[model samples]
Target: MSEEYYAARIPADIDRPDAVVARLTFRQVAIIAGTGAACWLIFTAVHRAAPHLPLAILLAPLVLALTVAAGIALGSRDGISADRFLLAAARHARRPRLMVHAPEGIPPMPSILPKAWRRAAGPRPAPLVLPAAGVDGAGVLDVREHGYAQIAACSTVNFALRTSGEQNALVTGFGRFLNSLSGPTQILVRTRRMDLTGLVADLEEAAGALPHPRLEDACRDHAAFLAHLSAHQQLLGRQVLLVAREPQAAAATDAGLRLSRRHAESGAVLAGAEVSVVPFTPAGAYGLLADAIANENPGGFQ
Candidate 1:
């Protein structure tokens, strides 16, 4: 008897809008219809005003321009429709240029500054609303009204190097973990620039204390190689994090307890798949959150 493997083909465009008419999406159809209606209204108004004007002279250019505009709106660039891209661009243009990390709200400009100078200073800074309210000593994040979430750092599995049977086992274990999830869970994978300067420093410091001269020399050479590598090449480090969130309860302590239990359950399940999960400490979790915010907003926050 042979093992059986079943596979199904899934569309890459699962989020794509469905075509409603003539292979055109509802949005595209609406754009075309709106353009046509506007053209008709213009044509009617112009003809009523000047009955002597030729229809071709009035219709040709107007229809051509509107049709092109509608076509552009229907078209897509970089996987996003032109209409959506334009809307996003307009929104970005209207948004405040400066943002400050004030959870309460942005205060009014000082009364001391002259009114004329204040007017010339452009728009006032907008408040930055972050998702996580705070983190506890146990690394559980307080998401305010949403709930508490605990993040566990997970070790990766080398699926590509595994045998067919091993791969099947791993998949089965992962599927089990997914099936066991009761609340909102998120798996995050991110890459950050790797800094080897500290590692090189540690190696250099330890090299002098080696028992043998040859061992000391080897350690020194390795440290030099790492320093050279860090200076010449860009290195990236990948992190896999599992976040388990439990909805807020009447008592905050109950919510935190539920989140911790969920985190432990997830770790136990993942262990079957040869993956180790370690929850981040308070300081580590806060540091990760800060770094993530800085990366996302860049110069927007002071």
Candidate 2:
């Protein structure tokens, strides 16, 4: 092969320019010309009206020049005009439009067409996709979308209550567990406001079932105290999740085997760390996601 043949076929400057010229779009040029013309006309009229005020006339052009410079600097839209930006913003604001439905008995409001209102169709709600399809009897969650099949759940411990030595041991054990991981895994911590509704309901039921008046009264008082505390205190619930995902390429029959192996390994690791771990079922996973979403956006599911 010739040495010259190995060189680039084209000059670099031909494909990529060494120096690019800065230019303005039609709208920007029009705006600048119009503003300059209007300012010139105003300045001329003011000078003619007050011929003696020479200082005012001199200051007018200086102020106009400064105003024009500021507008050009601040009104920038990546070298595009403000009109295009406004149009794009208006279009984006129209997404996820809402629809209203009237009751069967009540008559619908008379449709009043306004000149500015464009009758575009309202956007539909997006479909919900759960992380896991279902859990097998062997306790493996089938996350079909991500191409992973595994069992996972959260483990919690009161770190503040542990001694320095205990905390050190716990950290060392967890470090070793992470080093031993041979597949994909995720550790997450989610915090949410504690929901005491169920506890309140249970207390109410217990109070109602109590035969003795004194015991029933005490139960009611305790329930009220708990409700008050929950209302006044900002109680937060923190859940630590450990998710292990095995490769989906494993055979269908082998899914259960892989799940069991991963589950046992993770549990043993947690046990060694002196932390209790709970494996989440498919339903549990779904509920967890729903709760998380709800906490992030109130009434989001509804």
Total clashing pairs for each candidate? 0, 0
- The local distance difference test score of model 1 is 0.85
Give the per-residue lDDT digits (tens) of candidate 2, residues 213-248.
Answer: 999999999999889989999989887877777766
Q: What range of 10 consecutive residues in model 1 has the weakest lDDT sum?
A: 293-302
Where in model 1 is the C-alpha error above 4 Å? 1-4, 52-74, 103-106, 120-122, 295-302
Model 2 regions lying over 4 Å from their true place: 1-120, 123-142, 149-151, 208-214, 232-234, 251-253, 295-302
Q: Candidate 2 — which pairs collide?
A: none
Using TM-score, give the best candidate's number.
1
Question: Among these predicted structures, which one has the highest lDDT?
Answer: 1
The TM-score that candidate 1 achieves is 0.83
Q: Write the per-residue lDDT of candidate 1 for residues 1-302, one digit (tens) a residue.
A: 56655455889998889999988888888888888888889999999999999999999978897878687667888999998888999999998888777767878899999999999988889886678888876788888788788888999999999877778778888999999998999999989888899999999999999999999999999999999999999998999999988775665577778877888888899888999888888878887887887565433222
TM-score (all chains, Cα) for each model = 0.83, 0.53
The superposed Cα distance between candidate 2 and the true structure at residue 253, in angstroms, equals 4.8
